[model samples]
Target: MPGPVSLAEQVKEVWTSDEGSMAKDTASNRWPKIVQGMVDDVAETAATAVDRPQQEEALSIQAALKEIKDDMLQNRVLRPLPSDGRDDIDGYNERLEQLGGKCTWLACPWLFGECYLYRRVQTIFALTHHWRDYDIFKRQKDSTFAKSCKAVEELSARYMQVIANSTLPGDATNEEARKLLFVEMTEVALWGNATDLSLLSNLSLDQIQSLQGREAIAKSQRNIVDNDTDAVWQYLSSPLRFNRRIDIVLDNAGFEFFTDVIYAAYLLESGLASVIVFHVKDFPWFVSDVIAADVESLFQHLESASIFPNRSFIDQVVPRLRAHFDSGAMSIKQHSFWTTAYSFHQMKALAPGLFKSLQVSSMVIFKGDLNYRKLTKDGLWPHTTPFKDAIGSMGAESGIKVLALRTNKSDTCVGVESQERVDALNEEAPHGVWIRNGKYAVVSFSDGEKTDGK
Candidate 1:
């Protein structure tokens, strides 16, 4: 018989009912066919896998999903306090935080998207089941990292010129060169959003051809936050020039962490920055940030066959990715920068050493949606507040050049300073949902020295 379900498993058992149906609705609306196909593929993969604890669990999950799909098809009504009620909302978020504490390994990327948590939760509220919010955090922790492709290699080449020009030459003390380096570092920070494969499929991440055309660039721009796109682009190619080290407030793990390491390696390889600091969570974080196991997994991704199935693509990328780590062009320093909860206001309090260390880097790039959320206090501001003030004394206290390239996921959004900008967004996208969607983004730049309230 199957062992009794653990708390984590119990939380994830939502797919057994209709109460946990939010994921089903969202999946149907945004990516019905894609979700269905992925589920079907998982079922096929499960049937072929050798027996193991994880594989068995995967099979069980596959079985559970069929019921969830049937619930969706039948238009089952769940009891979970009506999906829109505050009780359901609070219950869902509370469960996420609870599950958030259980797994610190950063393995739960699929909670909000893939994995079975959301789907299960939707089923949990079936009229036959008591109305209760299903736990959505379980699958979130499971689908955190997966395979990669040639996107890393293509990205390495795409930014090569930018990287080379952004660094300083030996014995070249020209002020212009320093300024240019600063600009370059700043822009490097901006382009951080150019490609993120965490949520994409293994095939998508692996295909080199996927990086072609203006689609990647367009995707990055659409993910801009606060509507300060020019500023974001300018920051991308801009140099920090300040006499300081570089700090990357990191997010995700597995391939995403590997990509971040690659970016750090590029900074050092190009001579753009002296020392690089990586700030990671002290505990399990918003899923897929970084954990002890992540370092090993990351190296495997770097060394393993890349996202491309072709051996030639792998041959070309292996050396470059290896060279970055082998040459000591990058070093990672893990710190508890993410535990400050929703506000980076406590950033100074949590890691004063990091604040002091930023003095050495020309710039600091806080990567991903969670860090951005903390920076802007989850977009709960008055909406007219300046980005600088939103960040407040956090950056000002240390005189670090703060550049964040983040898609709008959580609430805290800034840098859109004009009604015209808002109007433009409405014209481009009539839906007010643009603010919350990750499709539109902002590249917010704030100089610690400038009091102009960015």
Candidate 2:
């Protein structure tokens, strides 16, 4: 059998080749537009600067953005991140140098280059005065959330119904029922990834709604190709369940984030976890990855009568979320490692503090495709490779339980039961198209208990 194909090798396949996959679209279309949008935003914000120095800084930032866009279009070699006094910049530059000192936008590793693109964009704002804390993607994230009102209402109503009927801690009568609810909530969180902005850049409100709600989930259950939710439930319900803290490495901002919060709320309310810590990126990332401000934005939007039309549902749900924050049952945390290009396999070495923090959690749930890719080192491993093996150092014996709830949207996947299953999928869809469509998913878990090196 052939050894696993690295992401760089997979880039030569039609799915990742310059033909039509996300790599092509991202480098050729999405990034240039994103940079142009940032340029426009800087111009608009600069007009409102309070003083001359701030205005001058904004203009300089705008010029820097334009130059970055040009370099991307010209396929120039990737450059080192300017010294921003942030600890991670050195790590990023070192990685770039390791990859090859002359890697270009299109020619470089897809995962690393994509990460580098965002980090380079951050340098422009980091060096600026008034815009240092601004999020270039905030407007897009907010607008996407605004447009997802229908889906939001449906999920809020459904989540509330589940909560109303759920059995609390120590309620043994409906243990089976509670288990079913856990599956449903996990599925809800899994499918919510359909709305990620990186892949569905032109997604419409109707398109988003079609992918959400109870009906959508019911119809899509069969599409979950590799399900370990039962194992996850067992892990959570066993002796290891008590006084548990669950860490969520979050994904996109809009509807997906809403569902993720609902899942966290369910875990807390069911006493499956004592605390839920949400890990968000420190800056704008992959277009819509959640950051600290998004949490605030979500609550503020829920509070505003003008934004979301479902006032009754908001009234019921928003307070529960706010109470989680108020009573310290929930928390939002950020780490520079999340935004860095280093894969989760490198977590122990690259970010030991974050690694140690996750070790204390009952299970750390990594959400969405990018997180999945990072977990597996974005390698084209045989589809039947065990989930634990794919995750490397973060797998068994690492003392950090992990559950990856992801809709397959990239070329890399593992943990399926057999190569025959993967062959059947390829036969059905041809050319690995089934993996990138976002119609299928994987609910994979690692128990973190094995001590053997094998």
Give the candidate number with the greatest TM-score. 2
lDDT of 2 by residue, 1-454 (tens): 9899744344222222355566666677777898898899778877877899988888788888899899988988888889887898888889788877988877776788888888888888887767789988887777888887767777777777777655445456456556666777788888885543221112122332343432443554667778888788877876543588899999998788988998899988876788999999999999889999899899887777777766877789999999998898999999989998888988999799999999988889999999998998887677887888888878978998899999888877888888888888889888777788888899989888795422
lDDT of 2 at 339: 91
List lDDT for all candidates, in order.
0.49, 0.79
Question: What CA RMSD would candidate 1 show?
Answer: 12.7
Off by over 4 Å in 2: 1-21, 47-52, 168-173, 195-219, 239-241, 451-454
Candidate 1: residue 303 Cα off by (Å): 1.7
